[model samples]
Target chain A: MKFPFTSEQLTKLHARIETPALIVWQPNLEKNIADMQALANRFDAALRPHTKTHKSPLFAQWQLNAGAKGITVAKLSEAEVMAAHGIDDIFIANQITQVQKLKRLRKLHERIHLTVGLDNPRQIDLLRPFFKDASTPLNVRIEIDSGLKRCGVTVGNDLVELAKAVARQPFLRLDGIFTHAGHVYAARSAAQVEAIGKQEGALMAGAKTLLQKNGLRIATVSVGSTPTVPFSVRNPAVNEVRPGNYVFYDAMQIALHAAAPEQVSLFVLSTVVAHPVAGRLVIDAGSKALHTDGAGVTGHFGLPVNIKGKVVRLSEEHGVLELPEESTLRLGDPVLLVPNHACAVANLFDVYYLINEALQIKTVPVEARGKSQ
Target chain B: MKFPFTSEQLTKLHARIETPALIVWQPNLEKNIADMQALANRFDAALRPHTKTHKSPLFAQWQLNAGAKGITVAKLSEAEVMAAHGIDDIFIANQITQVQKLKRLRKLHERIHLTVGLDNPRQIDLLRPFFKDASTPLNVRIEIDSGLKRCGVTVGNDLVELAKAVARQPFLRLDGIFTHAGHVYAARSAAQVEAIGKQEGALMAGAKTLLQKNGLRIATVSVGSTPTVPFSVRNPAVNEVRPGNYVFYDAMQIALHAAAPEQVSLFVLSTVVAHPVAGRLVIDAGSKALHTDGAGVTGHFGLPVNIKGKVVRLSEEHGVLELPEESTLRLGDPVLLVPNHACAVANLFDVYYLINEALQIKTVPVEARGKSQ
Candidate 1:
């Protein structure tokens, strides 16, 4: 009861598995992984999850073992971590720059079928040398900037031009054109997200067509995020979907109708440390645990869900509660908190508690917790 | 350069530090610590740094060795971690709650002197049992809500009544009053923050006088926050100042003019991992490395400066640089990004590199990184 693990097991591994440790609920994670696997199978599309969510090689293995075709990583470091864990197929979904990274890519190319996403022609030229010596060459994809306005080349000839350049890279292989309908996150409703997903699929398909008409062979069209997966996975043009948070959805994901609340597998288990003042109760967990990720503008500071019994208000280090004017919260009560955004919160710690529906606990390593490089 | 420790060192020890690690600039931290030490010396007031910024036991040891009277913890878990690291004098700056946490607090009490901040009568009742057997009761300070609107009881007769209630509890000791003018964080200018600091000091002093008039001994009047410290330190009525971020000022703190950019001791060191496309470069660091704690209205993303020597948009693990219309980023470039908020970013990492001013690296443990209890 004192630590996350059972007292019997805790005593045996007391020194290594320290308290203030990130406890993983394995059963919950297994359920989350199974649910996502079911969705990908139902849609008949590859679930190449973006590993940035949990950044765990173990979780990536779980996903692949659960029938995912490949794993998506946002950084080369994440790919490296995954590679070390024996994940051979990696999709570096973000733009890659710098010769150092290219060298690493070149090395990885020798070991795995490596694909990098790009939004510009210069990147194709930059990657030429890394692939020049390789027999299979590097796989490249042109990323289209669909309404998010964050990255990627905007629609039309600009995207087409980028794609052509990718095809022209002497040692690079132009596999496909991809776009993440990131704006789907701001969807007003689930209906809007689905509509946005359709538009996103069309946009990628349109870009692929433009490239094909210009005499380029586009092998795949990919578009997906946890929010858009439910809407985009069934699209015929899209061969793969990368929805990371689906494995452990959070409150914002639920609000977006990405998953039902019960489907959320991750939570912050906190203890009430102090009730120094009435109307304000402080919990042992703070921003360090719950994180300052304001996924959606909920009136409360964090996503407050009824976990077992307590209604908690998350503060920086203390989840404050405006105790009922009549009721009181004593010190040492444990409360469960579901965060607003699972992805960001998941990245905050080195491990997580894999708890079952019955609340049985298991520890799992967040193998990719710090794989930002 | 590949591992946090040097190749020679890592080879010698066979210890693998996590990669894409959050490396702290150590000599820079020492300078920052010394500067704050000088500040406290100049003002002749005790410096009790809030440990929420760099929750590292190693750093806490450095601060205490350099002459911080005590460590100020925002939560009980942090206090517990610091205590584990031999930091005996601690002040829980926030209210405490949860029964399990109280038990931990009781366990901690057997070892160190603790002062907990409180604002209401019910909190007094909760602490009575813990203090019942004490020869010298645990100290409690009433927190005055001064415009931050986060926590603390608003100053006035209610505060006086609360202090009186504490006086009535035989097991509780009314230490004094404290207020954190967090509103100063949004100050447009130093003059504004200074003025706010004056108002905060007046409120703390006024509350103390009111408590004293009502037969409660006013032992300490503390008013502090990095933004208010420069001004509030001059207030004679304020016996203590708790400014944690000053030890490693951040971009937001610098923007608020609380500290100059040079005073910023901490920064996230990231590598240019990929240049997938021109006009868009990705760094190994993103929301996970430099947390997405943006300056809400100021639009500061808090990235360590220059991703490929240019500003970039951050995705989870990759920072997407939107280069100037004609800019070019080559592969393998290293960039420095000063996060907008250092505290949250620091909290995300398990260990950090301590680099000298010349950028020579010294490794240190972020011992308290995941101490969320």
Candidate 2:
């Protein structure tokens, strides 16, 4: 388990670097990436992993290098950052409504293979002009709400109408139908996660059949989420799967049985900066590094694990570790905090740590740490 | 009001600048700084503004330039950044415990007039060696918990004990008693906010009396939050006040009656990127930008404002807008959304909108947006 950078280097770097700095582990990251890539290979589906998780240009390169079909971005800025980093194939997984962002999208389309996810017929009309002007028509994917009732066209006739509407646009090419089983993250076990995944894939595949019968060309059937992927591959209709958080699973992922403890790739490395009371020791990391979130409960936001200690409360900049014994913890020790959700935690910092299993520092950047605008 | 940069220049700069860019509004920022300065001056207290709000050297310069006696930071990195910017006076308002951080604190003490807050007696031991090494001993303030029962020495006698402990340390100076009425943000009205402020001031003053009776010299008595200042200034015992969010008040600040609408200096300038339904238009800003926390509500996170049009709901990266039926929001119109909690929103992005009253784009770089790390 020899790491790229020695422990002495990390200690030295720690001295030079400021406290509350983000420290991402490199070995865990590569392992997580390999695991997801293997799952994609097993499914025989295109691995268009979403880039919104890390948001670092360096992480995007890793995903591309890992044999992903393309990148999926939630915003135009994210896509633009990836594009600037020379990532050409991108899918704006959410709808594009803003004219200013649409202009950016059209500009992006001029040079890259840009596709957008659409949930409504009006959205199709909105993108029609850009489709007509492009040298090649922009690819459109109707996002079906399989079970997660957040965004997307509800399964059934509504989805059919949206797909047929896509066919009506002469310049718009209907690439496929996509669905995200976001609800699968709440699954209690692998069995429940698989069930949700199958349902999600079936719904998207069903939408594709309806569209094909309605004289619309369906090229891809996409469905995914970290929790749903294992079960989803069983459905042959799903051509591609997109799972973002699998690369850096968090406390929620573990609680939902999506990933094991060893599979988690990210942790907020913090130091115990203050011992204000007999039982309480405050760490350097706070809401800013760990974003305000806790899994399975309210009030307990970030998951503070005792690397060798236990954290009880988190203030804006200090994490309070409450212990049973007064002398259990020392003043200058570094602590590892597994955040409730990794995606939001990744969004909190400009950079991340790339340490190994032996806690050795490696290549620091994970590519897409702040790809969001 | 005139801005430093024209809209066209801003647009061009935004287009040409690096991807993952952070844009800030200079004029709006100046207004925020000036307003806070006037309030601090009106109260006749030494304004030691919290630098944690905007952890940029440039903004720290603005506060110092506007007549702040000192800049307050929550971590060593923030203090280091401020020190590099030539900010000599700094107060690490949170407790410092880790030996590594104490080592850095000793180094920081050499260049700047540094003071740190401590609540428990255990912290005294951690600071003892660091202060002994520095030519000038480290100034330690006893933080009293004035209703925000998160961190601090809550009891009066405990404060005295901590002060006595500080006095006993060869390297520690017993500065005074300080507390933040963080619960003031939960207050519903101006009167309630003022009452919390006065209560906080009285509690600190009470702790000061306890320390004074113990034969310890308490030089500074401080208590404040953005909500309590106007109310707490009436208490003559308080000598210094540190309030961070006053510079860029948010919708929550407004809802708490802490600030007027015009006094709010920062807003998330996003675009209406998608229109899925006639009433439902989505903006580019989502949970990552506006934050997931609303003022006591679950789904309601940020302020839904009329930009060029209207916004209703905000998802992760998509803000759903409920516009008038007769009107149509095109693909690319930019909208200014005033976030619910400016402090949390500031933590999300790397930059902000430095704007004029007419909503024209100006020089944008609230550089310390992610200085929390």
Candidate 3:
């Protein structure tokens, strides 16, 4: 998963395309995809790679071609985009409560084998009317709060109650349980991430058992998140793994010890547009290109792959890099930056300039980019 | 500038459209535009409304119809989009160093009156090869570092040298000098913002004077930024202002005392999708919809307009709102959140839902949404 381009190759490639562009090193991307799928195979779990990272149907198709059971999306709009692109199996890893969106989901479920996450009874109530009396029952996976505290219910009475509520609706089939260990990104060490992952697997598996004892049949047990997938997938009770950021391990992944720096496949090709001082260089890619997600976690906007500098500040269209005093970076020079969070960064671009091992370049549309509805 | 919808109106509108949508109150938007225009009129300066905020050519047209002399953009791609939409007058308030983008800029200049910002001799050199022998000179504005150290040359011998270098190129017209006091966003008080604004105006005017003493004819002297516009426009030497964020004031502007809470025009209409805990409610709008810009400055992701809660954390598709103990927000309820930074939030969506005073809604495309190249 090492960066496949040399300095000369990168400079030549950089000259061919526009700055502030998303560049995917094809070899590294394919390797990362293969490595994650192999990991799922080693654990004997279904590899359902999350499309929320790349947001490209082409990349999702690549994952599926490499033996992914299904694709995972965060929004119904993204699922629709993937379904239109012939991705039949999708699991929306987030909750959908609105009736308007539920109607769209019902329409989408007619074509694809869809499964949505639900953590509350109210969401089941919202789905009942729209899905009721349909020829095919919609699949529902109860979300267990496995240390992320963002979404999902705790693995207790709340979990059993939510599962029972989904089971009560004849049109809504209680599929299984899923948990995303998002808090592992904030883990201080690998050991901490392992602990959270172990707890995540245990909680979801335990929740599955608890619901089964309550006369609810749960088919699939899933655990996800890039950082925690290695440890979480060890549980035999878990049948599916959905790790999104593994496709393009970012600076945050490196900080979490979940990935090596060379494994990062995604880069924002930015040109040094301004050298206002001896130690300050400004790149054309700013928050608009790199995003502001990982700066809070990493304390830096992005990591420069080719230069001895740190992206210290970001405006709308300007990324200010603070270079070492002896650095030789100048104006108009290309700087490849590995964004702190690849998922958020991928959402900003309309297309990705993919470079193969032969240094050949091609453009691929980020089909699901801005599909945030 | 008050939000132009009642509770019933908002409830009805929220039900009609999908959640996690960008909503613009039309009355507040129009009033914000007119108020900024009036402020520019009071100072006898031409209002070149920066279209980087709305990224919509229709909004730029509204500003032009309301007496704006031109539109300002941060990228040449944005200028091309605005030009394609018939916004003939444009100033790219950023430096372009790549030859490819410069060629695009040159072609765009042929179709309209185009000006670009310049800070160093390298940019002047980048422009020389493209505009050395053109039908008309490309308008170049020397950027002076007012207070924000992100970009621009200092108002010293460096400024004189940069301006002289621009004047040396016969094909590059030295039309003006400009500076943006972006550091005013960090001002702790209104007085500090006013002080930064005064220094911004004085430095630009001094640069103009120094350049004129060096035998260069500088037609325009400009200073901008939403917070400093009120104080910066008062300087008589400044003839043009480019304030973008005044179009949709957000939580950051309110924190800087530049905007009242009611003057905020933009909102993200999100539905409560998950109530995992008693005090925690998860909304559909996350960093993907609301953006992560203002979270660093305000210590909150976004301010919930209708709900008495703070969006404490945000994932890619979920916003975690921590509400009061007595809060009654439930699943399926719609909450309007004012983003921390409206410009960043606007970049995330392809279209904005504009709601008029009569509760009518229309979709407007963000024409230059991802024109970051």
Query: Which number leads on lDDT?
Result: 3
Highest-DockQ candidate: 3
Task: Count clashing residue pairs in model 2.
Answer: 45
DockQ of 1: 0.32
lDDT of 1 by residue, B1-373 (tens): 0122333442222122223456565656788787777787787778888888888888888888998898888767789888987889999887665444566677777789899888667666667676688777778888888877556777777787888888887777778888888777668887898899888878877777777777778878887788888777777778788888877777788778777766666766555554444565556666777766645523655543433234445556656555655344344445555777777887777677775545455676666665565
How much does each candidate deviate at the interface, measured as C-alpha RMSD after superposition? 5.8, 4.2, 1.0
* Fnat by candidate, in order: 0.47, 0.47, 0.80
Per-residue C-alpha lDDT of model 3 across residues B58-142, encoded as one tens digit per residue: 9999999999999999998898898988889899999898878888988998899988998889887788888887999999898
lDDT of each: 0.69, 0.70, 0.89
The model with the greatest TM-score is 3
DockQ of each: 0.32, 0.38, 0.81
Error of 3 at A49 (Å): 1.0
State the displacement of the C-alpha of residue B314, model 3, in Å, after optimal TM-score superposition: 0.5
The reply for model 1, stretches above 4 Å from the true place, is: A1-32, A103-114, A124-136, A154-173, A271-286, A295-300, A307-315, A318-335, B1-31, B124-139, B154-175, B269-284, B303-313, B320-332
Instruction: For model 1 chain B, give the 10-residue run with minimal summed lDDT.
Output: B10-19
What's the best-to-worst order under TM-score?
3, 2, 1
What DockQ would you assign to candidate 3?
A: 0.81
Candidate 3 residue pairs in clash (backbone atoms < 3 Å) = none
Q: Which ten residues in a row have the lowest lDDT in candidate 3 chain A?
A: A1-10
